[model samples]
Target: MSVDPEIFAKVKEALIDALGVDDDEVTEEATMVGDLGAESIDFLDIVFKLEKSFDITIPREELFPDDILTNADYIADGKLTADGLAQLKERMQFVDLTKFEADPQVQNFGNLLTVRDLCSYVATKKA
Candidate 1:
């Protein structure tokens, strides 16, 4: 799926608002778990938020393993899965209710600006 800067911006903002993190720290290469302190439950919320915000269902194996969403070795490997491509099939549709549910991470969502999140955000938003 193609990248949409506008949608990426929204995801970035959503993460920043949710996580209470600074924008500069939320870079594409940043590690969401080790560097960002994302717990398993928090990661789950991130996954759900990603699906809701962008309207896509990430494959379970690719998105969640050991119950977390991270970028530990993604930059070197490109991507561990194709969830971004899946989300990219539909871009213009925004699921408003996804954001309002207030998942655990929603209270601390702002700082999850990893490459994977960016790709998923852009894909889902642009879908």
Candidate 2:
């Protein structure tokens, strides 16, 4: 599915507002769970914000009840790049932390990186 250019801007804005992170730090490869270190509730909140911003129906399973993606899936998706499609696919699978220093709230997300969170967050994105 094709996403809008503004979707990135909106989603990135939501992320920064909700999570107190920098927009530049939120690449498509950045999973809400792993890279941003979002909690289950934080993720639920992110899902809500993302849904509202995108005006898309992100299923509950996509956010809470699922398999999502795996570690190998991360390699498969590649990392988030400037290309929206690639970044979306990558963000669907994993979160890149190369820009974490710019966002201190990112440090607060460290506890949310369970393997279950990792896979589920990715799986949700693909969904």
Candidate 3:
């Protein structure tokens, strides 16, 4: 799905304010953790900023999905099991999981979310 330009602008602004990143660095493909230097602790501020900017409530599970990551039923051998990947797909339709699906390593999941994904999520929430 194409990202809404207005949503993208808001998301980019929120990411910049929360993460202290440059405007040029907040590209659609930039991973939240890898490219934008977002840590686990930064997510709270990011979510708060997004909610305030968009006037929508964002539940923690909708963005983080920690339950699936930490669940024994969804993980095995440092990677997500097939069922786990399926669950992630179901939960994070706003995210493009193709790259993460290729590896499915729990460690790599931190880098899965992109600016574009955040914009899509906001779009979904606003809808």
Candidate 4:
């Protein structure tokens, strides 16, 4: 699912407006936390901006699920269960969980999400 250039631009604009980042920094491969320096709270602002700009409602849980560590259905003891991984993969299609699949750590999962992921999600919502 290739993102339309126009939608990509809109997503970038929303990110820039919400996170106050330079245009060059908000590339498709840039992770919101690692590359673009987005804090946890910044996600709420970004989602709000995207919803208004695109005129689409994005369910918060679909984009950022509750902490898996605390969710019993997603974890067991200290490891991610198969059902949990499947659910995560479904919700986070934009993320490359190949490496994480081998050792699914709760803390690193959120960082795996990239700017392209958010853009793709918004594109889907608009469609």
In terms of lDDT, which candidate is strongest?
Answer: 3
List ranges where model 4 is wrong by over 4 Å. Answer: 67-69
lDDT of model 3 at position 2: 81
Pairs that collide, model 2: 28-91, 29-91, 30-95, 31-95, 37-109, 68-123, 69-123
Pick by TM-score: which candidate is best?
3
TM-scores of all models? 0.47, 0.45, 0.96, 0.89
Q: How many pairs collide in each candidate, listed in order?
A: 15, 7, 0, 0
Model 2 deviation from the true structure expressed as Cα RMSD, one decimal place? 11.2
Task: Give the clashing pairs for model 4.
Answer: none
* Predicted structure 2: lDDT: 0.49
CA RMSD for every model?
12.3, 11.2, 0.9, 1.8
Residues 11-124, candidate 1, lDDT per residue (tens digit)?
666566656678887665565765666666666666677677777776544443322224333212333233432232232132222332233232232343355555654464
- Clash-forming residue pairs, model 3: none
Candidate 1 contains a number of clashing pairs equal to 15
Give all candidates' CA lDDT scores: 0.49, 0.49, 0.92, 0.83
lDDT of 4 by residue, 12-117 (tens): 9999999999989888888888888888799999989999999999888878877554588888767678888888888777667798899887777667778888
* Candidate 4 lowest-lDDT run of ten: 61-70
